[model samples]
Target: MQTQCGGCKQGGARCCCRCGCHSTAASGGGARLCSLSIPSGRSRGGGGATEICRSPREGTRKAGRQAGRMATRMFEGKDHARVYQKYRFTPQEALQKAVFSYLDRKAGAFGLALDVGCGSGQGTLLLASRFQKVVGTDVSPAQVEEAQQAPHPDNVSFLACPAEELPVADGSVDVLTSFTAAHWFDIPRFMREAERVLAPSGCLVLTTNTLDMRLHFRDRDQELTRIFQEFRDLLTPYMSDKVRLVVGDYEEIFEAVPFPSKERITDIVDKVPMSVAELVGYVQSFSMFQAFLKDRPEEAQAQVQRLQERVLEAMGEASPEARLEFWNRQVCILASRGPVPDHDPRS
Candidate 1:
């Protein structure tokens, strides 16, 4: 399933970190998201004197003050760009964590694997160790360049390509996987292409985590539903009629695409206990939040305050431990090629 709502505009549920946000301990043999406390001495790098990885509240007042002053002067335009690029790698980090967790459990299932949009080679590293042959592909030359430099066994390689048009020949890959990057893909075309490339019985694994995005003064879960509805509306323009049919249901995925003899969908929520500060960092990472502030700064700022206060109230009542939850779903679609032919039926 694809969740495109970034967490900024919506604060509480199913936002960018909305769904991808709340991570919990691993159950059902899959990995879960957890908070890694920033060491005391660790510097909170640029981005307006904000605390590193804490709730937005800790720095919001100061940040708001700074943002107000800087908003007038366009402070450090180039530096902001640099920081954005550097920290924008969170999604990839999350993807790598998921891939490795999968490898830790099912590495022996396939001798060859394909990682689509294998940015920075993080996922490829794990695939290379498990499969005798691994091919990583992406659309960005810069990403591909970085990926090429990453160390891999002789069996692993990286390439640049779009999802609709993969370079690999037909019926060759033993296992096919896409990380959190699949939402950007043209699902129908990618599925057709995936089916074409997989050797009979190969599995196509696709996953994208949506953070929890909440509306101001709305029930936490209610905000999630609103954000999802808004996201659905946003995607309507981008999706083809064929792809549109599959929204909010797994059955649509199977019906529109041919492959997939068997399929299973699992929701893996990473629930981390958090303070107000950590929640804000998670919120700012969202594209919608960035855009919301860009288009409607006054309104966005107000929403930010409400979310921070709501979280603080929760934290006060929370256990001695500050908890943050990063929730995500891992959807695995397994399909078989030719039927049992030579000997298996009787054996």
Candidate 2:
């Protein structure tokens, strides 16, 4: 059975709901003010097959200070990259199936798939399974390195580049995708790049899972939920302004897609059964959690430990696994250049 909130009654069945969430004003507009066009003399695919384009170093001392003034920043450093690779969960199969189904129906070619902001190659490798070639790009060179180190097919490659300055030829990409990473991007610039690189009948798909997760135990669901919510509330102050796009369930993001025939599918819930330790590790992977660690390391450790202890106590001995249902409420924005022709008329 399915609930109004998109939760499933079965063990691992995913579901959805149609709730109207409020959208907030766009942030990060003045943070990195730069022209949308590709810089003059920079040809498409100018970067090598696996190039790492390091952002130019700050020239003057004051330039360094100005760079630090940006409101949003990419996740960097070796520690953060390691934590992300270790703790981040894989993309749900249901979500992948949904994405591929849409592409198969509408996209005219599977020539090239570009996954912007692809951290550690999770979603990039998924695209590789279906597309002829896949390229994953991230602003953080560390993240790109981690992605490159991960095992993947030969057709998959990693590049260090910002979303706005994609090193791809115009009208060359058949599928452009961003998974849980677009909120950190300069939306207008990224959208412009997407429009420039995507082929005439290519497709652009952006997806993100919401933060409102639910935990379920046989008899202590409420208690577990309360514990998780309180922990989330503590991390809210450390979160960046860009997080508003995700909290609104991508309502604002959907509107930003520069296409007339776009679709937004929200409330796609996925339930995964995991141990209490795994659940705690999952929480530790959050960007805000990393921020909290930076600001108050001792307090963050204490709170996370307390959360784990509480979860273990509530789960009882018989059932060591708890249902970690991500009300992943994924907002999948899908848009194609135009209608796809059917070679097989019957199909």
Best by TM-score: 2
What is the TM-score (0 to 1) of candidate 1? 0.49
Clashes per candidate (backbone, < 3 Å): 55, 0
After superposing candidate 1 on the true structure, give the runs of residues whose Cα lies further than 4 Å from its correct spot. Answer: 1-109, 119-128, 141-157, 210-250, 266-279, 290-310, 317-323, 338-347
lDDT of 2 by residue, 1-347 (tens): 11221122223322111010000002211111111122123335554222112212211222224324421455676788877877677678668777877887888777678898888878888887776667776776567667767777766766555777776667778889999998988788788888898877789989887886878877677887888889899999988899899988787878888877778878566666677777777788788998999899999999999888777776664333544443345667888876777332224
Which predicted model would earn the best lDDT? 2
Q: What TM-score number comes out for model 2?
A: 0.77
Clashes of 2: 0
Alpha carbon lDDT at 125, candidate 1: 65
lDDT of 1: 0.45
Tens digits of per-residue lDDT, candidate 1, 1-347, equal 12332222234433211122221111211111111211122224522211112232322233334323322112112333232333333334444565445444333246557787565565566666566567665554345445555455666655445656664546656678865455555567778888787766455666544433332222344543354345434433333333332234344554555653444344443333344445554454344455555667786677666555555464343332344443443343334444322222212
